[model samples]
Target: MKVGLIGFGKTGRAVASVLLESKKVNLQWVLRKSTTLEHRSVPEFLGVHSDEPGLIYSISEFSADELFEKHPVDVIIDFSSADGVDYYAEAATKRGITVISAISAYPDNKLKLLSEIAEKIPVLHSPNITLGINFLMIAAKILKNIAPYTDIEIIEEHFKSKPEVSGTAKKIAQALDLPDESIKTIRAGGIIGVHEIIFGFPYQVVRLRHESISREAFGNGIIFALENLVGKDNGLYTMEDLLLPYFHLNETEQMFIEKNTKPWWRFW
Candidate 1:
């Protein structure tokens, strides 16, 4: 797969580092708002030994149309600001390129625009794209389904600079129909991110937690998304959509159950 990246900030740089090291995908180019590193090779800038032409471009120098024509890629992984979608939506749609937006938040209007573009190609939008976080969400939902009356609480922690509640935590809360008050926030040190969900039953407490030790986790999530998004029908998708198919028991497990377990009526 050939990949294009948007945004070269702290997290973006980390993701680029991971992509440059991967063998499965070729990183064609990266677009950033600043011109400080314009026209530079990403691999050289990051000190990685690769020959993939991982160049960097300033958004101001090249229009989206020109960039897409010059370096067409299989997919565009966006870790840019919420408005970054406006820059590539039309061009990407025209080329039928897959899009994976890891933007933290998007207003209603932009979300509607994403939906509109999804009509032409596969589009995935995720606030928190880390694989562990998405897996945590799926597990939390399953636990909720199993114990509907269990008392649940969501706790999110981030760096001290981030004051607002985490969008991911909110999504987890919404998934379990939890009220805002049920969420607890903690801001400290340089923590990348942490989300923990606690399920309180009559006899025991269950906790599911996902912690990001590094921003490279986002790149791993992008790789996972790319692997699954291929040949998908044109539509809007989330990480949950890509992961749900894997939650079922395998054939061997199912066969074992069938062979070993008797029907409830037989015991009665």
Candidate 2:
């Protein structure tokens, strides 16, 4: 797959590093709001060795239409601000490019715009795009479904600089139908990110925790999205949608079940 990236912040740089090292996709270019690294090679900037022409461009210098027309890509992974969608969404949709938005949050209006654009091409918006986090959410939902009365608590920890509650924490709370106040936040030294869901049962306590050690985790999530989102129908999607299919039993599990089961007559 040919991929383009939007945003060049710290997280974006980390994601680019992961993408540049991957063999599954070719990173065509990266678009950022600033011109500080304009026309620089992403690989050279990241000090990696690659020949994919991973260039960087400033939005001020190149319009989205011009960029897409001059350099086409199969998918566009966005790590930019929520408003960054306004810049490339239209052009990308016109070209039928899949959009994978890892933006942490989006206003209602922008979300509506994304829905409209989804009618033309696949659009995936994930507030927390880390694979482990999304898996944690799915597992939490499943546990909630199985044990509806279990007392659940969500705890999110991040770097000391982030004061507000995590958007991902809020998402998990919403998924489990817990009150916002049920979320606990811990701000400490340089903790990349941690979200833990505690399920309080009568006999035991179940904890599902996902910790992001580095921003490159987002790139891994993007790669997972790319592998699944191809050939998907035009629609708005989330990380959950991409992950739910893997929830089924694998071949080994299926074989184990088959081997362990006996006919009802054999029970006699």
Candidate 3:
């Protein structure tokens, strides 16, 4: 499998390290721009940086039209910023390449547009790419069935640098069918990430939580997504699709993803 990566930051670097060490995936062009892969280690290319040596791909720029011609790949993984969302979706759809995106904090409309793009290609986007958190989302749906009337809410905290409410919180809320989620966000000093869900009823309360001690939490999920992306049909997939064997979701979360169908014309 040939793979292309964007975003050489923490999670991106870790995932790249694993893929490189695996010796199975061919690292294709590592594009800085979501668009054009036109140069070869040209140095002036905007966002390409490799602290790790012996990478298989050249650091370069890539346009949507030139992607397959330059760096042909079965899959493209993005841990990039929200700005790369549409460009990745557009580029991948053009060549029928599957994209696993862990990019977050974009507006809902952008996500809706990505869903439309998925009708054209296989696109799986997750805000928190930790299998644990994704399982929590499925768990949230289950707990809702057990305590259907409980008042459930999410509280998430990250480092002071983290700008917005976590995408995981929103995922939890969406899993439980809450359009307006009650999610608390706290940004403190150097904290990695902590997420908790509180379900309160007449008798007692249930608290389910997951904490991230390192970026490996994120890497684990990304690698899992990449591994399962092969031989998948074209559609918008979520972590639930990836977690079917290990964790079986019985209700909303299961029926939701499994039954989702988008119109072919919606891709336009």
Writing each residue's lDDT as its tens digit, candidate 1 over 1-268 gives: 9999999998999999989899989999999999899999999998988889989999998889999999989999999898999999999999999999999889999999999999999999999888999999999988999899998999999999998999999989888888888999999999899999999999999999999999999989988998999999999999999999998889999999999999999997
Q: Model 3 scores what on Cα lDDT?
A: 0.72
Full-model lDDT for every candidate: 0.93, 0.93, 0.72
Error of 3 at 217 (Å): 1.9
| Candidate 1 clash figure, as a count | 0
Please list the residue runs of candidate 3 whose C-alpha ends up more than 4 Å from where it truly belongs after superposition: 33-60, 179-181, 248-268
Model 1 residue 241 lDDT? 98
For model 2, residues 1-268, the per-residue Cα lDDT tens digits are: 9999999998999999999999999999999988898899999999999989989998998888899889999999999898999998789999999999998888999999999999999999999988999999998998999999999999999999998899999999999888999999999999989999999999999999999999999989988999999999999999999899888899999999999999899989
Clashing pairs in 2: none
**Which 10 successive residues of model 2 have the least lDDT summed?**
60-69
**Evaluated with TM-score, which candidate comes out highest?**
2
- Model 3, 109-153: lDDT tens digits are 777877887888888888888888888878778789977989887
